[model samples]
Target: MSTIESRETSAISGDAGLSLIELIIYILLSSLLLSAMAVVLVNSWSTQKDVASVTQATNRGQVIGSAIERAMRNALDFDVDDATGTELRVRTSLGGNLACQAFLLKDGDARFTTSSGALPTLASDWARWENGIAQYASTPFFVENGDVVTYTFDIETDSAPVRFSGEAAARSTATGVSSPCW
Candidate 1:
């Protein structure tokens, strides 16, 4: 009878704490949720980075291209040895009295030469060339004297490519001498 009474008392007692198995299961579920969230966050970050790089590269490329175009359009003097061939000399205005010259060369590839002390600065994801042709970072800006100036900006990073080649066109003091060659 006493044993029966003790058993009844034990059964009546409510559960006070979680069992080891329950605790373990809870921990595992929480860990799994956290891990999944981490993965999602990492993936988002990676995609964002890629997008940023591409944008930067493109902007850089545009700047270099625009600079070349402006120079070509503003050229006070120009010389085209042969239209069939890709070599020309152009003279244009620089900052203030400083004159800027550029030579364009377009063969199978393209390159350019500039008078600027520093090369063109693209958006921010490409390389700048002091001389010689580089891989087409951006489209060819212009062609003169077998030299090509191409500007490329990085799409994914903050780097740009400004490519210069050969010697810039010679600047002439003559303001309005309408000659075939300046």
Candidate 2:
């Protein structure tokens, strides 16, 4: 073959294959990019999970708080455990004086019952009344008063242990009487 042709052939062959140095660089870059992507993905997943848990706990707290407030506003008489504030009893004016009691367990669950041992409806997903105890694992909610009757709700879930709290005030059904909603 002509020297030019031979040289051209060798050049083409050499260009077709990667050298060891080029291969090593390519591998290192691939590894670094993959590691970066993996870190980002892991962080994103953890944050999303935390947000979901917090959102769920917040929603549960709101529903439970609303239900309790409604029941209390209409209550003829009420009793709360002073020691723990984890239990509540209410005598309501609805119909023929409905007596209800709620017990909150430390496991982040709750149960409610009528006076005669009848199971009350589950107002939300966080609580279930089985046998006689309402169980849950989390922090507690407390009542606060202002111009309107205000209460705070706080809750936590297994995945996210941070407490979520909010204030809710009652809305007065009639004028002159202030409601908490404001």
Winning candidate number (lDDT) = 2
Once fitted onto the true fold, the runs of candidate 1 whose alpha carbons sit more than 4 angstroms away are 1-14, 77-89, 93-98, 103-182
Could you tell me every candidate's TM-score relative to the true structure? 0.50, 0.64
Q: Write the per-residue lDDT of candidate 2 for residues 76-152, one digit (tens) a residue.
A: 44544456655555554444324344434334455554442332434342246422122223333343333222333
Off by over 4 Å in 2: 96-99, 103-109, 116-153, 158-182
Q: How much is the lDDT of residue 155 in candidate 1?
A: 24
TM-score of 1: 0.50
- Worst 10 contiguous positions by lDDT, candidate 1: 122-131
Window of ten residues with lowest summed lDDT in model 2: 173-182
Best by TM-score: 2
Residues 47-153, candidate 1, lDDT per residue (tens digit)?
Answer: 88777865655555454455555665566655444543333345565553223434443322334455433323321222232222344443343334423222222
Model 2 earns a TM-score of 0.64
